[model samples]
Target chain A: MLKNLAAKAIVPVGLTVTGFVIVCSILLYSYVKQDLVADSIQREVLLGDIIVKATRFSMLTDQRESLRQTINDIGEQKGVEHVRIFNKKGVIMFSSNDEEVNQLVDMSAPGCIECHSGPVTAVHLGPMDQARNFVNAQGEPVLAITTPIYNEPNCSNGGCHFHAPDEKILGTLDIGMSQAPLLKSLATLRVRLVIFCLMVLVLTVGGVIALLQRNVLLPVRQLVYFADQVSRGNLEINEPEGTEELVSLAGNFKRLARRNLEADDSLRDLQDKLDTLTRQIREREIGHKSGN
Target chain B: MGFLRNVRRPPDTPNRAETAAAPGRERIRRLHRLAYRGLWGMAAFLALSLVAFNHGWLLPPISDGARAVLGKAPPTNLISIALVVYSFSALVLILSRMSTGQGKYKGWSHLAYLGAFYVFYHYGNALDANFWAVFAAGLTIMALEHYQMWTFCTEAIRKEEERLAQAERLEKFKS
Candidate 1:
């Protein structure tokens, strides 16, 4: 894209046009990436904070429902795709986007395996990657973290994802935030990086081209002009003394001039000798004719 | 696939003889004037009528229905709209210049007017008033055709042509 003649022209001015575009692209990509990441992290942390707090409640009371509403409010933040709830047993309790999956999610397997069927951590799954641990229950760069909650009864009893008969322990509170926003942030970052790279590449290319055109091509063109002069018998034209390269060029021109001078001298001597012979021949012819 | 097969290939070189026989650029311009000016006038009229009928002929026609559907009507500063209009006019000027093949001086009084208007609207209360950015960074690219109208001054192009012609003529004469 930068290889156009317009880009070539700019080389003499400063950076090539192509170089300027590349630099702009790189800067744009970096800026997009930074903004996207920042937005995603903000949303994720907000969601996680709200979810972790909500989990502490045991009953399926209005308060528990309110927790979903609170998360829904937070979910509206830019870049947030969805908010979800999971029990310790890995059952999906409430989801902001999908209402059908009221089934039990198996949280038995450690890490992300228990609930997520896809390539474990690759997707945003598990109580952890969805943010099972971190400050405000939100994780860092890897995934959002949030505290898993079981009802007080379940907590007061032994350790389990749910409650027993008369063992009225509330379900484990798991908040699954949409990683889409985070991924989007990352994608934006990727684009920004690409733009940044393009900008740098362009600037570098422009700078290099500019230098080459000014310092190399212009001088070489001048040298060519002088060489043409030498070829046309005007060997008196002076060569540049800018560098060793120029010095060598001047030497070559000098040699060609000397050779031409030598050839001219030889031709002149031959012409003179021919004229003298002609005169002698004419004189002999005249003297012989008179005797006859 | 069918379209691809049916697509005709462009000739390697234009048929100069046929073009030479055709009417001049002025005739072409007259034809364009008849065709597009009428079409644009009609289209703009209809669009305005439809909008006015639905939401009254005035500024900020944020329909209640729209508000109901979107939760809130997407709010935009009216001054921004005026600025956009000015930028659009400048873009049109630029296009005119380009069509005449003499584009230059893209930033004209109209663009400044738009920015000033934008500031006038946004000035009193609070907020940043920067409409030049809209014209330069946004509208210029969108309305590339018009940018030339404002930028492509006739004198500039004529001078360039004169210089080029003189140099070529001088070179040939020397040769």
Candidate 2:
């Protein structure tokens, strides 16, 4: 029956296990999401650094076209959303998207908030400062990394171009990478985690029910059947065999049955003896009466 | 009928002391029965409380009292305390029922005490690594004692009863 002890016991255990599994799955999903975001930021930052390093020589030689070509080539790579070179005035000097070049960028955007948020005029770029995530114009997720190009002594002291020695930073190279692929993969992982949790819950409940049937329900049912037989005065019925505890209980019942049958036999014998003695005494009295 | 016809009536007799003691003995027996039932009831209550507390299914006043005693949050699996209380109550019940004259029941009482103690110890320290070893040792000792008592009661006592019955039957035939 659905209302049996096995069902009752298994329901609580199943609920506990399922709850634990769901909690663990949620924790795992959060951890994985954080790790994925961190990994993506690190990769994009490294890419920005490489782009800056590759274009430094061209910028030093004043080969503007070659520098722009290098930025454009890197931007065209798989997962690369956009790459741009910007001046200290927040002006886009070069860009993978040509239309955006020569346009002034908004300094208050999410990508620039890390550097512009403080009273300190000069922002010291660190590894963490180089990367950020924001929603693009199309509502797609984008990872933007800003790598600063420092003014070197060679550029300031060179004969071709005049530069100020006090200029701490020359420009910033901004690289934006698409997060669509990473998001898709994470979505797949989430789905898989949900499926896995459901499977684990099902398996746990099913296994518990099976074990309860084997270890408890079957033995208890057998004992109940044996008890019914005993109650009906079937003393000759064989004992039910089961697990060690059940076997011991059955053995005790069988011994009790045997004892009861022995007692019944003894009582019957005593009653027969008393009956014969009473008949003999009755006959003796009748004979004596007749003689008198 | 013949037996009653042949029997002679004895003189009417009364014992004031026996009459005075009868009520006292009856009262003591009633008290014993009540005590046994009360102990079992306490054990049942303890079990129900344990379940209620662990599952957060307690009534308002009892829940408030539990929270006040054990703090706002208590461990959910406190079945061990319930088990210990139940076992101790059963042990006391068995001991109360045992008498000096009933040798069989006395052995049973001792066995019950040991068994209850073993249950308490085993469940109380169920999280321990040495649970199986301790349980095995207690079970072995209890089983040996049980076998000895059972053998004495069944074999020796049954043989003596048979001997007495045979003697009685022989005397009846001679008479």
DockQ-based class of model 1? incorrect
* Candidate DockQ scores, in order: 0.02, 0.02
> Which predicted model would earn the best TM-score?
2
Error of 2 at B161 (Å): 45
With candidate 2 superimposed using the best TM-score fit, by how many Å does residue A33's alpha carbon deviate from the native? 2.2
Which candidate wins on lDDT? 2
Model 2: clashing residue pairs? none
